[model samples]
Target: MDWKLENIILGVTDVDRAKEFYTQSLGFHLDVDHQASDDFRVVQVTPVGSGCSVTFGVGLNGAEPGATKGLHLVVEDIEAAYAELEGRGVVSSGIQHFDVATGGMAPGVDPEHRDFMSYVYLNDPDGNSWHVQEAHHKGAEG
Candidate 1:
């Protein structure tokens, strides 16, 4: 059997607001937006080049808005990703590089651009957080 992760559910106070944030601010591709009834709706968006998408809607998520945390998005070029997001007018925690020797984090991308060492954090309008990490390996290495 093949097991593949597909979608994540995000709780949002307003569906249209969240949709605009994801589609316009964060640049995710809108996959679906369906309203089954006045109380039920579903909206899905996928990041560019990502196989997994995120869904948010009315009556679909029971968790509190902004409850989801620590979701990750990996990229080969940390600085480029940061620049693109910044250019899009998205607010972020700025790039931070992790020190393997002391496990300390400091501002700016890794000097050597090591995989999994550089990161930036972003939050949606509802404050659902996501970690963007520089990972050249792309999970090919064990």
Candidate 2:
């Protein structure tokens, strides 16, 4: 069995705003924006160099305009990313740390990872939320 991460669904209050955010701020390329009905649109975006894609819209299987949460995007740099977002008028939700001692946000992020990692949250006008993560610790050696 080969299970692979395919797509993420990001529910946004406004499709245009979400499209602009993902494309302009996060550098995701718009793949598809299919309008299936008068009440909904299917907007998909793919990261510049990623096989995974995220889809957002409305009226998806009881998914209203706002019905997504806790979506994580693993990134390479946190500080530079913060600066870019700031330049684009986006605000951070404060720095979140991982507990190194317990592997659960130990008084800030682990020091071994250069202590340069953190997550800053942002929200759209309709309260749709997303965060930028600055570290990659998948195999326990990152």
The residue-by-residue lDDT of candidate 2 on 15-129, one tens digit each, is 8888988888667899998997988788899977677898888775534555665566666666566677777777656556666556654333445554235676776555556
Candidate 2 worst ten-residue window by lDDT: 106-115
Which regions of candidate 1 fall more than 4 Å away from where they truly are?
Answer: 137-142
Error of 2 at 3 (Å): 1.3
Off by over 4 Å in 2: 36-40, 99-111, 114-117, 136-142
On TM-score, the candidate that comes out on top is 1
Q: Report lDDT per candidate.
A: 0.90, 0.68
lDDT of 1 by residue, 10-74 (tens): 99999999999999988999999999999899999999999999999988855689999999998
TM-score of each: 0.92, 0.70
